[model samples]
Target chain A: MRTGTGAGMPQRGAVGAEERIRAAAVRLWSERGFHGVGIRELAEEAGLSSATLYHYMGTKEDLLADVMSRGLRRLVLAAERVTQQRAGAGPRMNALVQLHVLTHALRPRETRVVDGELRALSGDRRGGVMSLRDEYERYWRATIDEGRASGAFRVEAPGMARLALLEMCTGVARWYDPGGPMALSEVALGHAQLASRVLGAEELELVDEVDWCRGLVGEIWSGPGGG
Target chain B: MRTGTGAGMPQRGAVGAEERIRAAAVRLWSERGFHGVGIRELAEEAGLSSATLYHYMGTKEDLLADVMSRGLRRLVLAAERVTQQRAGAGPRMNALVQLHVLTHALRPRETRVVDGELRALSGDRRGGVMSLRDEYERYWRATIDEGRASGAFRVEAPGMARLALLEMCTGVARWYDPGGPMALSEVALGHAQLASRVLGAEELELVDEVDWCRGLVGEIWSGPGGG
Candidate 1:
C-alpha cells in the first residue's frame, strides 16, 4: 500500500504537532533506519524545526524509543486480535500469518523501523520493546506447538519453526515493493501457503488440492509479481 | 569463534593497524549497526586518532563497504567451495547448508554486518555487494531447480523456496549467541536439517540423511553458541 493514503494514514489531521512529529519519525526510521538518520534530518523530513522536534519527542533516542514502542504495541495488539478471533491453533496460525503479512506489506516502513532499529533505543526502552517482541513470539511458538501436538502440523522443533516462519514474514518489509507485480493480498496468500508448508501441513485432499496446486503454478508462472 | 582469534596462531605476528581498525569497525557495526556509529566514535573505540583512521579507511562509508564486501565475498567463496566439492544437486545443497551454517556460527559479526548493513553502502559499492549476494543466491536457485527437475526436491515453486531457505539461514545471525546451549557445529547441523526440510528433500531417501539430521538437531540445540 502507498504511504500517506488508505486507512493506515499517519494521523496528520488536526492533531497536535507532536503526533505529526512521531508519525514522521516512524516514516524516516523505517526508511533510513535509526542509525542512518539524524534528528535534524528527521525534523527537516517532517517539515518541523529541530527545536520543535525536541519539544515534541524530547531526544533522538526518545523519538526512536517512542516509534519502536508504539509500533511493537500495534503488532502485539494485532496478534491479540487474531488470537481472539481464531479458536484452534491452525486457524490462529493462519490468522497470525495473514496479520503479519498484511501489516508488513501495508506498513512496510513502520515495521522496518520497529524491527531494524531496536538497538538504538536506550536500555530501558530496549527492554520494554524486547519484552513485547518476546510476548509476540510466544504466541507464535504456542501456536506451532499446539499444531504439532494436535497432529495438524509436523515440525522438528516448534521454537525454531516459529522463528523461521516469523523471519519469512518479517522479510516482507525488506523486499516488498507496492508497485511491484503482486498485490498485498496475493503476497499474504503466498506467504500463508509457504507457512503452511513450513509447518508441514498435510496435503489438501482432492478438490482443494487441485485448486491450491493450480494457484501455486499460476503464481510461479506469473514470475515475481508485486511483493 | 572469538574475535581476533583464528584457527592458526601466527606467533609474534601482531595485527596491523588497518586490521585493528577493521576489527574495531566490525565490533561497532555489529553492536550499533552500520549507520549508528560515527567515525570519531569509531576511532575512539579503536583507540586511534581520527586522522589516522582516514589513513586506514578513506571514509566511514568506505569502512562499511569494505566490511560488507569482504564478508559477502567470504560467504560466496565458501558457498562455491561447497558446491565444487559436492557433485550433484542433493549433495551440493547439503554442502551449501553446512557451509552456510558453519559460517554463520563461526563469523557471526561478519554475517551480521553483511546482512544488516547493505543499505549503508552507496552507488557502485552497494551494487557490487548486491551482485555478490545475487551470485550467492544463484547457487541456491540453481541447486533447487536441479533438484526439482531431477525429482530430488518436491517443491511447487523453486524461486520462492530458495528465498524461504535463505531467509531461514540469514535469521541465524540475528538471534544466535555463541555460548548458549549447543556448539557451533551443532547449530550448523540443526540448520542443515531445517534446510533439508525446506527443500522438500525429506521425502527422498537420499544418502547422508542421518548425518544431516544430526547436524540439524545440533544446530537447533546449540542456539548459536555465544561467539
Candidate 2:
C-alpha cells in the first residue's frame, strides 16, 4: 500500500512525505475536480518538486484512484470490524449508521472526493473503485436483508431503503461542522435513530454504540491505515 | 431576472440563446466546480463569443447565481402549488417528496449546480442564493412541524429528520437514470414511502400524487419557468 520511498528517506517513511502528498491530493482534488487540478499544483501543495511527485506516484489519475481506493478500503475495514460482533439487525444498523455519520463528519473532504469523483476515472480504475464501493455497500445490504428475513424490519424496497439511508448518512459530510451547536454524539445518535425509523425497526438505546463508534473512527482515521 | 438580453435579439430572446447559455452553464458547472471553469470555455460551450457571453450574462459568478436562483425558484413555485390545496400533513409531505424527487431526477445537472456551488460565490451573491435555498427549505420545515403538531408524524428531532429526508430525496439526482429498470413513478413513490417511514407516519397511497407531480414537473421545468 505504501510507495515512492528511497533508501535515504527511511526516517520519514512512517509518516512524512507520502502522507503530505496524500493530504495535498485530497485537499486540491476535493476543492476542484480531477481535470481542474494539475501535477505542478499538487507538487507545490505537497511541498515537493514535480519530479519527486512522479517518483512517489504514477499519473494524476493514478493519484486520484489511489486516494479513492484508500478511503473506500478504509470504510470496508471499519464496517467489517463494527458489524463483526453485532448479531441483531437493529443494533447492527445502529452501529453502522453511527460509524458512517461520524466518518463523514470527521473526514468530509475525503468523503467528498470518494462520492464526487467516481465518474472521473478511466474504465479499469473506475471499475476497481466501484468494486470497493460495492463491497462496502454490501454490509448495509446484508443488514437490511437479515432484518427482512428475521422480520425485525419492514421495508417495501430493501434496495431503495439502503440507498436512501446511505445517502442520508453520507450527507453529514457535506454540512456537518464540529463547531456547530449539535454535538457529534447527538448527530450520530440522531442518525442511528433515523435509520431505525427508515427500516421500520424498533428504536434501541444506541448511546453506547455511538460512543464506541466514535472511538473506532479515531483509531482508523488517526492510524496509518486511513489518514 | 435575465441580464444578457439585448435590443436586437428579439427572435432568439424567447427560447433560443438564453436557454442555450443556461444549459451550457449547468452542464459545465456541474462537471467542474465554479472555479474550475473558465469564461472562454463557457462561451465556447454556449456557442457564443466571449464578448457575447458577457453581453448575455454578467460575470461568471453572476451566471452561476442566476442558474441557482432559477432552479430553486422553480421548486418554490412548484412546492407552493402542490401543498396549497392539501390540508393533511401526510398528503402534503407525500406530494413534496414526489415533486422534489422528480425535479432532481429530471434536472440533475441543475440540481448539482444548485447543491454544490453555494460556496463559490462572494457575500452578496451567496446571500441571495442562500435565501432562495432557505426559502425552499422552509416548505419542508413547515410541513414537518405541522405533522408533528397534528400527531401525524413522530420523530425525535424534526430538524435532523428534515435534513436526512432532504438529502435522501436530493440523492435521486446523483444516480437516477430514466432508461433504468425502475420507472420514474416507482422511484418517486418509493421515496414517498421512505419519507413516511422516516416521519413515523402511516404510508399513504401516493400513486395519484406521484402522477400529478410528474405532470407538474413537466409544466414547470419544460416551460419558461425552469428549463
Candidate 3:
C-alpha cells in the first residue's frame, strides 16, 4: 500500500518546518500503519527532535485526527463547490465525481488515512472526525438524492449507489501514478463515467475542471485552519 | 474496521486447532494490521502457546502468506465457478459481483490483509502471492472483455470498468456489518445491479446462486492445499 520509496516521498521543498513534519507524518503513517510508526522515526523523517514534534502537533492521535480532519474538510469544501458550480444536478454530479477522482489521486496518502484509520480514533476525537466525515458524505448523498428526484439519475437504492460510487471514485488513491501512462485527467473522466453508469444514467457526461480542482485542493489543504 | 468484539467473532463454535489459529490470525491481523500484530497475542487468541503456533504455521511471514494465499485461492476458485456457471457473460459477471461482495462481506479480515498487505511480501513470497491475485483478476478481465466483445457490456475502457467494479464490490468488506440493518442478501443484490450498471448494461440481471457461492467459498477455503 506504500507509494514512494525510501527517499520518503518528496515534499514541495518550500514547506515550513512544521508543515514538513505534518507531511512526513502523513507519509510515514500511510507507509507504515499508525502503530508501526514510532516517535523517533517520525521525528527523524521530519528532520526534527521528538520534543519539537510535540510542539507542532500534540500527541500522535492529535496529529492523526489533524490529518484526517484536514483531508475531510478540504473534500467537503471541494464537494460543496463542485456540486454548486455547475448548473444542473447531472452536471454537478459529474463534476463531483471528476473532482473526487482528481483530489484522491493527487493526495492518496491523506485520503487513504482518512478512509482506513477512522477506527483508530475514539471518544470525542472519534466523534469529531466522524462528524466531519458525515458532513463530507452529506454533499454526495444530497447530490445523488437531488439527481434521483430531478430525474437526472435513476437508482433502486440511492444509499447503495452512493456508497458504491464513492468507493469506486476513492479507489483512485490506491493505484494512481503520475509516472504511468494513465493521467490524472483520464482517471477523473473514467471514474466520472463509471459513477454515471452506477447511478443508472442513460448518457455520461465529462467535466473538464481539473485545474480548478487542483487550485481548490491547494487552497483548502494548505489554507489557514485546514489541519 | 474492527468486526466483532469479546467473543472473537463467533466461529462455528467447533473447528480444528489449525482452523482456530487461522480464525484468530484473521481477527487480530484485521484489527491491529499485520505489523501491529504479534505471535504471542496470536497464540493466546488461538488458545495455544507460541511453540504450538510456530509448529502449526512456520514463521510469521509464512502464516501471513498462508492467510493471504488462502483468501486469494478461494476467490479464484469461486470466480472460476461463477464465471462458468451461467452461459452468457452478463450473468457470469453478475454472479461474480455477488459472490465477490458476499465473500468480502463475510470475510473482511481475509480480504483486507490480501488487499492492504501485498507489499509486506518479498521475493518468492511476493511473487507467489501476486501470481494468485493476477490469476483471480484474470477471470474478471476475461469476463469483462468477453462481455465487451459480445456487446453485452458497454464500456469505453474495459480495464477501468473492471477495476471500478471490483473495487466497488470489495468496498463491502470495509463497511458491511451482520448486526446492521442492511442484510447480506440486499448487499449482494444491490452490488450485482451496480456492477451491471458500471459495465454500462441497460438491464440488470439477478443472480440466484448466493447460497451456492457461500458453500463453494467454505469448501475452497477449507479444502486441502488451499492455505
Against the true structure, whose lDDT is highest? 2
Ranking by lDDT: 2, 3, 1
Candidate 3 structure quality by residue, lDDT tens digits, B1-227: 23233354553322355677887888988887877778999999999889988887888889888888988988888888776667788888878888888888877778898888876678898999999999999998998888889888888888878888888888888878899888888888888888887787767467666787778767776553363
> Candidate 2's residue-wise lDDT over B1-227, tens digit each?
44445556543652566677788888988886777789899999988888888887879988898989998898998999977967788889999998999889988888899998887788899999999999999999999999999898988789888989999999988878888888888888899988988898854555447778878888887765363
Q: Which residue pairs clash in candidate 3?
A: none
Per-residue lDDT over A13-56 for candidate 3, one digit per residue giving the tens place of the 0 to 100 score? 32455577778878987876776688888889989889988876
- lDDT per model, in order? 0.69, 0.84, 0.80
Worst 10 residues of 2 chain A by lDDT: A6-15
Best first by TM-score, ranked: 2, 3, 1
Assess the local accuracy of residue A120 in candidate 1 as a C-alpha lDDT between 0 and 100: 70
State which candidate has the highest TM-score: 2
Over 4 Å off, model 3: A1-18, A222-227, B1-21, B47-58, B222-227
Q: Indicate whether candidate 1 or candidate 2 has the larger DockQ.
A: 2
Per-model DockQ against the true two-chain complex: 0.40, 0.67, 0.63
* TM-score of every model versus the real structure: 0.80, 0.92, 0.87
Q: What TM-score does each prediction get for chain A alone?
A: 0.79, 0.90, 0.86
Candidate 3, residue A156: Cα displacement in angstroms equals 1.6
Total clashing pairs in model 2: 1
Off by over 4 Å in 2: A1-15, A203-207, A225-227, B1-16, B203-207, B225-227
TM-score pick, better of 1 and 3: 3
For model 2, state the Cα shift of residue B81 in Å: 0.7
